[model samples]
Each structure stands twice: as C-alpha cells, then as structure tokens.
Target: MDTYITNKIMAVITTASNVSPGGAPVFKCQSKDDLYSITANLEAILDGIAHALNDEIYIIVKH
Candidate 1:
C-alpha cells in the first residue's frame, strides 16, 4: 500500500471580493464562469489539482 499527503496551496481563484490575500497568489474573477475557466487553466499550467471550496472559490494545490 502507498499513501501521500498534500497540503501546499499554490494559488487561489475566486469571484468574491471579500477573500483575503494570504500567502498564496490570489486571482479575482468577475463571474463564476471566469473563475472556473481560470482555475482549470491554472491547474494545468501549474501542475496542481483544483479544489472547489465553494461556488465562488477554488484553491489550487500541488499533490
């Protein structure tokens, strides 16, 4: 058996303005569609996994 742990956040994509900019880079999108589009692109470009925290927020994490 094998196991792995992922805890690093590479980036953030969100449609909400209230989200605070933490240690990772934050990308603000104008709409839900834009958020999804950018998140997907970043996931591929950054070689990370996209995790939907909610309808308006997504965090890219490296595995």
Candidate 2:
C-alpha cells in the first residue's frame, strides 16, 4: 500500500464524513486535487476506503 495513496483516501473519508449528516457510515472522495493525484491508482484508494470503513462504501472521485 502506497503512503501517498493512503493519505489521499484518508482525506476523502474525512472530508465526506464531515459534510454529510450524522456522518453517514460510508466512504466518500470528492476532492479534485486528490482525485487527480490518484487517477492512475484509483484501485488503491478504493481499497483503502473499503478497509478503513470496514464496510461497503461509496466513492465520488472528481476529475
């Protein structure tokens, strides 16, 4: 697992949970910068989200 990729995923989860009501039990990624950084390694980010949430989650990667 790449540290850069991990950090990006963490950023996504943090941002999404903070914006959503009740902090829904789902993973989300909506940062264009972050998305662009991990465009070539999306699978790693997605995998990180799944592992971090420990449940099925949604990912919204902005181009």
Given candidate 1, what's the lDDT at residue 30?
97
Q: lDDT per model, in order? A: 0.92, 0.39
Question: Which portions of model 1 show Cα errors greater than 4 Å?
Answer: 1-6
Which runs of model 2 end up more than 4 angstroms from their true locations? Answer: 1-27, 43-63
* Root-mean-square deviation of Cα positions for candidate 2 versus the true structure, in angstroms: 9.9
What's the lDDT for candidate 1?
Answer: 0.92
| C-alpha TM-score for every candidate | 0.86, 0.20
**C-alpha positional error of residue 52 in candidate 1 after TM-score superposition, expressed in Å:** 0.6
RMSD of 1: 3.9
lDDT of 1 at 28: 98
Per-residue C-alpha lDDT of model 1 across residues 1-63, encoded as one tens digit per residue: 897546789999999999989899999999888998999999999889999998988999988
Model 2, residue 8: C-alpha shift (Å)? 24
